[model samples]
Every structure is written in C-alpha cells, then in structure tokens.
Target chain A: MSDQTENEESPLAGEAYTLTSEPKLIDGRRVLGVVPGKPSTGESKDLIDEDAVMVWPHLLVRHAVAALAVMLLVLLLALLFDAPLREIANPNLTPNPEKAPWYFAALQELLAHFHPLVAGILVPTGILFGLAALPYLDRNAYLKPRHRKVAITAFTAFLGIWIILTLVGFAFRGPNWGWVWPWNEWYGEL
Target chain B: MKVMDRVRHSMMGRSFFRAPDRVTTRDVAAGHWANFFLHIYPVKMRRKEISFRYSWYLGAISTVLFGSLVASGVYLMFFYVPSPANAYGDIINLETQVAFGQYIRNVHRWSAHLMVLAVSFHMARVFYRGAYKSPREFNWVIGVVLLLLTLLLSFTGYLLPWDQLAYWAVTVGTGMATYVPFIGDRVSEILLGGPAVGASTLIRFYVLHVALLPAVLVVVLAVHLWRWRKDSMLDMERSEP
Candidate 1:
C-alpha cells in the first residue's frame, strides 16, 4: 500500500493530527525496553549492558588495595613493637612534661591559651559540626573540581596552613607555656 | 568492550551517575601502580568525583589513620584494662613488655593526631567547594555532629593512658566543663564520675573511648557517606585551583 493511502486509511483518521511516533526504553519491572533512534554510542553504553557492569571490578580494586596495604603494615608493626601502656591507676604521681598525646597537646596548648569552652568545647565542636554540616550548606550545581576553583583553592590553602601550624607547634615549641621564635629565642634564655 | 560502544549511552545525563564502565581513578591507579606495594583496597568514592586533586585525598588519609588506630587498638586491648584503677599500669606494661608495643602505641597516638587534622582538611575542602549547598544541608549537619564526636572521641581517649598528661589534662578539661551556668558543677561531676578523675572517671572514659563514641561516629560517617551518594559528589567543574 502507498504511504499516503495508508495514512488516509489509518485506524483512526480523526486522530491523525494528534498522532506522534517515538521509541523509549521499556522501563518495566521485568525488562527495560530500548528506545528507537538512540543508536548505541557515547556514554549511554553502561545502561545497555547490565551483566558486565554488575561485577564492578574497579570499585573493588580502589577500596581493597589501599585499605589492605595500610592494615597489613600496622598489624606487622603491632606484632613487631609493644605499645606503651602506662602504669596502673595512681591518683597521685604526675609525669614531668604532663604532655598530652601529641595531637591534644595543641588543644592542651590551646586550652593553655584560651578558655576550655572555646578551645575544647566550642571551637573544635563548632568546626567539626560545621564540617559534617558542609554538604547540606553548599548546594550549588558545580560538579567538576576545576569548575569550583575558589572552593578548591580555599580548601587547599587552609589545609596547607593548618598542617604547617600543627607541625610548627609539634616541632619548634617546647612543653613550656613559652611561645618561642628562632631569633626571639636566641636573644632570650636559650 | 568499551563503554561507548554500548547501545544505551546518553550524552546529556552525565550528572545522573558516575558514568559507570568508564575508566576511573582506581583503574588508572591500578594500571599505573598496580605492579608494586602492599594490598591496597581502593575504595572508590561511591558518589560522583568531587574533584580531581590531592586535597581530595585527605578524607582517604583519615580513613587510613582510623584503620591504623583500630588495628593497633585491638592489639593494645589484649593487655590493657579499662578500669581507672588498672589503666595506667596497663599502659606501663604495654610500654615495657608485649614485644614492640611502643611502636604500636606511637602509631595509635600519632594517627589520632593525624585523624583530627585530616578530618579538618576534608571539611575545609567541602566548604570552599560550595559542596555544602542545598541538597547537602542535612549531610553538612551530620558532618558537624561527626566533627564533635571526633573531638569527643579524642578527648575521651586522652584519659585512658592515665599518665600525668592524662590526669592534668582531664583535670583541666572537666574543670573547664563546670563553667556552664547551671550545669557547670553537674556536668563536671558527670564527666568525672564523682568529683575528680578517679576510679569511676577512668572506667567512664574507657567505655566511652572503646565503645560509645566509635559507634556514633561510624554511624554518622556512614550517613555522611550515603548522603554523598544521594546528592552525588560536589565536583564543581567550573573553579580552578
């Protein structure tokens, strides 16, 4: 039959103007039917082949190797060295430096510097809370790392500064309340 | 077969999912360095790639540190008791005997320090990236709670060693907690388990360090992670630096 004749005699000629034609995936519970004209190409490939993707091997490689590497080293070291456990609870005697585990020494240092609420309770608490709350706060539609350069740069700089200051505290300063600088210390007692 | 050759490919839906079947950082990491090193489990961020930078690695570093702590912590647990009465002595024993315990202790100690720093850096990364906007607001809140829990975990862990540093630090810490108006004294007592860092306080801190806080942080961290999956990673493709 001619195309025009078929069109004229179509099942419902009254609905001819409203009729349209296209194909889409059969996203039924049982099967996802394919849409017509969307020839196989580009990034749409992963959706077409479910069987191959189900065994997502890359994810396993990323998580498995890095995690396992660290664990093994620590375990071997634990086996090799005995961790220091302090003496039985004595309510009395105090160690000389009275130093905190190195990390808290900064807070110990800060607690030394400011009120406990600010250093111990508030600031650290606020920062941590602020950190966890971050994803909820900034909802802009910038996905690629490069697109959000401001955020990236800021984060990078902050991290750099933080690390520098932390190391400075651990390395240059003593357990004393004194805040020392190179020239300042040379001129002072030491 | 290459992912591009498949039939259902779409060009516009890049934001929907992390174009599965594409070459990931893990694939490259494996291809590049797979030949060497220990067993490295590359736990790919299940969400979209937030950024392609070194800073992104900070969160991963924290995970590594936590893993270090858990492993060493378990070993230390073998000989250490949590009682305020026996806590200090156990520390001494681990230091003196049990074979190479000192290194384990140092790693645990240093990693705790590193975890705080790493988490802080990871937070800063999220913030400047504007990754905290809109859909991610709840996750940000979760991150904040996790942050507090991390600090609390660190604080509680401090007293377990029971050395002078532990004694005085907690002394000062709990002492400071009492500054709150009505609850100052009450809170201090609660934290101290009586009035000062004594038997009750030691046991309290031990339970907190070994049990309570970790559970909370892990749960929160899980949520924090799951939300990332939901909102997708906040990789802003516009900014540079």
Candidate 2:
C-alpha cells in the first residue's frame, strides 16, 4: 500500500499507471493506477492496432512447415526424376538446338529476334537495373493494386512477355532456333 | 512437454537458452533474443504478415532450396574434379559407383531449377505486395543482386557435368558476353579464361560456384535478413499517409 502511494506521488507517477490493486513493475517501471480512456497519442494506438504477434510459435512454426514442405518436394523430385547427363562435351559437335539453361531461355529467345546488343547485352542489363530501381522509380505511396495501375500493368506486361519468350525458347524452339511444336518434338532440357 | 520444460529449467539448459521458462510472452521474447538462429527474425510481426497469403512464403522456399543445393553440391564436390579429363568421367562414375550419387545429383539439379523459379516468383510477389516501398527499397536492391547471383551460380554449376549440353550451352551463353560493346572481347576472354571454354573455364567456374559466389550470396543474404528484421515492425502504410 505504502509502495503504491509512493509510486503515485513520485515525479514519474503520472506516467506510471496500474491495472491491478497491487503495485508491480512492468519493463522495470513501477505501476500505480490504471489511466482511464485512450492513450494520449495516436502513435500508441496505431502500434496497438498493428496486432503484433510473437514470432516464436507464430512465424517460426510457419517457416518450419514451409521448409519441410520444400524439402519433401525436393526429396520426391529426386526420387522421381534422374538429372540429365549427356555425352562428354565436344567443342566440335554442338547439339543441333544448342540451348542455354531454361532460366536463360528468355534471353536466348530474344537473341533470336533482336540483335545481340539488344537481346543479349542491353535487355538483360535493362531488366536488372529496372528491377533494382523499381522502388525508387515508382514512388507511389499507395499499396493497393487499384491505386497503382500503371506500375502493376507495366510489370505484368513485362512478366508475361518474358514468360512467353522463355516458353518459346525452352520448349517451342527446335534446331536452328526455329519454331517447333513441343508436343510433337520436345527440345526442352532441364 | 513436461520433460522438455524440466530440461529447459535445468542449469545447463538455462545456460544454453539464456532465458527462463517460456511461461510468458516476455520469456518467449527473451528466449528469441538469446537465440543466435532466431536473431534473424523480428521479435514480433503483424498478424497479417504471418499469413501464407501475405508472402506465399516464397522467400523461405527459395532459402530452403538453396540449402538443399548446398548440401547436395557439397556431396557432389567430393566426387567431382573440375577438368575436362575428369569432370565427365567423375559424373558417370558418381551416378554408377557412388552410393546415392544419382539421387543427390537429382536433388541438386531440381533444387537449382526450383530455386531459380522460387526467387523469381518471390520478386514478383514482392512487387505485387508493394513490399519494396520506402524503407524496404534497399532490401529490394539486395534481392535483385541475390537473383543475379542465383542465376550465376546455376549457370556456373551447369558446366560441371562437362556434357555436350553444358559445353554448347556455355559456349552460347558466354558467346553473348561478346556483345558488350567495346569491352566485349575482353569480358568474354576473362569469363572463358581463353579463346574458348576449356580447362581454365571449368576450373574458374568451379571455384566461383563452390567458393566465391556462395560466400558473397551468404553475406548478402545475411544483410538482407538483417535489414528485413530491422524493418519488420515499421508501419509503412501509416508512415506514407
């Protein structure tokens, strides 16, 4: 009781408020009495509204599940498929199609259409720089899709074109980088 | 649960954990803070951020794939010698003679391919979520660098099998470097370590794949996660308004 009264009378008493009858320490600050109504500032309210949850069981458990799921996927894939291994590399004998890895398929497709400068050098450099500069270039404060139409549209368009190009290069192209029906003759290598 | 709690409360456990029993939120937070592994994560995050839809956990998926790659890559390394003479034979011998070599190689191959997909998907997801805004902008740049590194690592590893696919693919791939304006030839030569892909190129790619690039990625990834932790609690929506 004496400690409670002392806390209430102390210079820091106005900041120290209790939710219980007994005086207690929270974060090393003594609690006196509960202040009625809302916090003085909106900042505190916003923080409360954030609904912050502990990362331990909450986020960690989710991450663990995600990790396990991917591991299982890799394990299953390893079981089902054998990684491709062709004959020994010979400089003189290039494969008819001579494909880059699938991830670079888009660039290879572009190289088929455009000059080496445009497809090979400039386009890749532009894409990387553009991606890196995205946050700064599109300084729009709004987060919702409706609020940021132009950025979303532009990005989606690029992504679509890139995906299409990748598909063309990876599966739809045959010898001499010519178009082929993948269903008829599969040239894709993984 | 009881046995676990008892262990947690024991002197050795207490010393290891550097926190009391997890009876309260404070205790949990304390334990998290004390943990070296958990240091990468924030103590708290908004409820929405933890939901699967918010992130699709693509970043976590990419990381796990990378881990799988690292494990399988190390195993492959034990059997591989980075030379045209030994490289192709080693892969064949590994697939036939070595225990689980084919499976581990498959794991590495699939994980590499999946990692490329996951990282790219993560970028798209981040863009859609507008997660690169303001305070998170630099992390986005770091992510781009990571994406480039991932591609490079994959491309380098592609050549290790010394198969016809690898040889021609790299020939075509490095051939593109010759389009880089005035310095084109120089860049191509530096990358190939010769007029064409040969012994030097294999050794060069091997070192970069195993040592240099992975080291850079790990360091950059550490910074990326650290920044993520620091910015995790920021209310970007409110801050903008």
Candidate 3:
C-alpha cells in the first residue's frame, strides 16, 4: 500500500523508478507506460547537452587560421635558415662522436648508460606500452586537477627524465662518444 | 552567420558560382552531410571544443606540420634519385641549382622535427587534461600509435639526404636494433638489407618514408579524428575550472 502511495505521489522520483509490475489504464487503454527513473549522475551522455553551435565559421574557420599560421611560420623559418647538408656521406670517414637526429638523441643517451637491449629496445617499448595502458590503469572519471595528483606526477617525471636525457645527449656527449661540455673547444671541433 | 551571408551574397563563394540561393546554413549542413570526406566531422560541435585554451591547438599544429612536410617532400623527390651513386650528387644539385629547392628541403626538415615535437606536446596536453578517461581510452591508444608512426617517419627520413649526418645517424640508429635479444641481427639485417646501411637500406627507407608510413599515418589519423568526433571531447560539462 505504501508502494502504491509512493508511485501515486511521484512517478519518477527514486533510484529504482523502473516500470512497476502493476499495469495501468490511461484513457481506458492498458499500457506498459514508462515510469521514468531519476537521472543518473554517473551517465555522461545524459549530462551532455547535444544542442551545440554549428561547426562552420567556428571550428572550421579557427582550424583554417591556425593551419595558415603554421604554414607561414614554416615558410619564414625556411627562408631564414638553410637545412644542414654536410659533404656527401663518406662512410669511410665517420665523424667522431656522430649523433643520431635530435629526436633519437634520448635513446642514444640511454644506450650510453645501460645495455643496448635494455636502453634501446626494452625501455622504448615499455614507454609505448605504458602510454597505451594509461587509460586502462587510471579509470577515474573526474578531470579536476586535484583528483589526478598521482597520474600528473608520474607523467611529469617521465617527461622530465626524457628532457634531461635529451639535453645530456645534445650538449654533453663528444668525441668517441665521450663526455665533453658544450662550451669546451673540443666540443665544437667535432 | 552574417559574415557567411555576405560572402554568399558576393561573387567569391563557391556556391555563388553555382547557384546563389544554395549558401544558407541548411545548405552548408547538407553539403557536409552529403560529402563522404566532410561527413567525418559533424556540422555542429560544442563551442568549447574549439576554444583556444581548451586544447591549445597542438594537434592542429602537428597536422599542419605534416602537411608542410608532405608538400615539401614531394617537391624534393622530383629532383632526387634513390640510388647511392646519384643520390648525394642529386642533393647537391638540388641545393645549388634548383629553384626554391633549398627552401623546400629546409621546410621539409624543419617540419619533420616540428611535427615530432608538436605531437609529443599534444599527447602531453591530452594526458594533463585527464582527457583519456572512460570511452576515450581507445582513442588514446590510437594516439600512441600515431606518435610511434611520427617517430618512425622522422627516423626513416633521416637517411634520405645520403650525407654524413644522414649516414652515421641512421647507422647508429639501426645499430640499436641489433641489441634486441634473439632476432636482433635479423631485425637489423632486414632493416638495412645487409650487415650495414647501403643502397638497399636507402631504397627501403625511401619506400617506407615516402609511401608506406605516411599512408598508414593517414588511415590511423582518420580513425583518431572520427573517434574524437564520436566521443566529442571528454566530459565538457566538467570542463570548467
């Protein structure tokens, strides 16, 4: 009897506002009508309002302008500087302390410290796998900075390590892959 | 809407060239809807998705860099020969003789470097924003793949110049592959086509750099963008500071 009163008072007021077992007649017709449930806070789809501004002149225009700006910057940089093209590759005359491109400099630095397999292959593969695994490992939904303290810390550490290693490769390593400060005369001689 | 209207009224609009009456918002939506390529992006999006600070537009910058690289690379290729004997000489000729050739090469090189950086920064931004949660997880995985592809693209292109920088960098780069346990030597051999970087390696890298990798990146990027549209920027309701 209490259930009936509750149903009568509020058609959609509680957590279990699913359809009741008792069928009801509406305008002389029996119906399995909806007893709408209270909105679920956990559901993101319900919270998002689909009505949004159109993409044209908003999204598309901004994207176009940003791309154009990038192109212009590239053009300016291209005109101001020349791409380094050293004497045609002489395999017989290897440059001392030869370096891989800057992007790979960190991996090369890693190779300097650990076994090649560990530094070059294992660590890189691990990093990639870890990145792919991030979403699965941390399933918390809140985007607030306070809620994600640990994740933010771990990522910052990873980024800091990479930057440090890259700097070590770029300015520290010299001839015969030996350590030499960038300010030293021998550093530029290479 | 008003600006679009004036443009439609003017002679410069594409729709105006065809039919003056076909430039309304409904027509624009219909146009995007009917087209296969354009349909990947919805005609409407939450305004916050485009806000400058929301994403810092790093992804867009990376895409632009990639476009610049492709354009400059294709232009450079016209005067380049993949063979060992002619490759270095071809590069010399390109710089010394060809019009805008040096500029094009510069742009390609810089763009490649910039793309790698931009992609990294974009990933970092995504992570910092906690945008990888919930239904957006798979998209994050795809983003990782794209990042790997970007690195591979940069590495493979490093060899094409056939210069000292190109030769030794790739040699050292490929030599790292040889440290991978059982199949290490086999991997290096396959990559270089021999015990060392040579003609086979150059041609192989050329093919991968120019054809295979870019094609794969494009397909994966398509899926990334499509999924982004499907997911529509993680929890925009909670986006406010």
Clashing pairs in 3: none
Clashing pairs in 2: A18-A33
- Model 3 agreement with the true structure over B1-241: per-residue lDDT tens digits: 6677567568677443333333345656666666565666777877666778878889889988988898889999899999889998998999999998898988998788789989999999999888888778999999999999999999998888898989999999899899889999999999999998999999999999999999999999999988987777445555544
Q: Give the lDDT of residue A116 in candidate 1.
A: 70
The single-chain TM-score for chain B of candidate 2 is: 0.98
Best by TM-score: 2
| Tens digits of per-residue lDDT for model 2, B147-197 | 999999999999999999999889999999999999999999999999999
| TM-score of the second chain, cand. 3 | 0.87
**Model 3 regions more than 4 Å off:** A1-51, A183-190, B1-27, B35-37, B233-241
TM-score of chain B of each: 0.75, 0.98, 0.87
RMSD of 3: 12.1
In DockQ, how does model 2 score against the reference complex? Answer: 0.47
Give the poorly placed runs of model 1, Cα more than 4 Å off.
A1-55, A72-102, A105-122, A125-176, A181-190, B1-61, B64-68, B95-107, B233-241
Over the full model, what C-alpha lDDT does candidate 3 score relative to the true structure? 0.81
Docking level for model 3: acceptable
Superposed by TM-score, candidate 1 places the C-alpha of residue A178 at a distance from the truth, in angstroms, of 1.2
TM-score of 1: 0.61
Better DockQ candidate (1, 3): 3
* TM, chain A, every candidate: 0.54, 0.75, 0.68
Which wins on lDDT, candidate 2 or candidate 3? Answer: 2
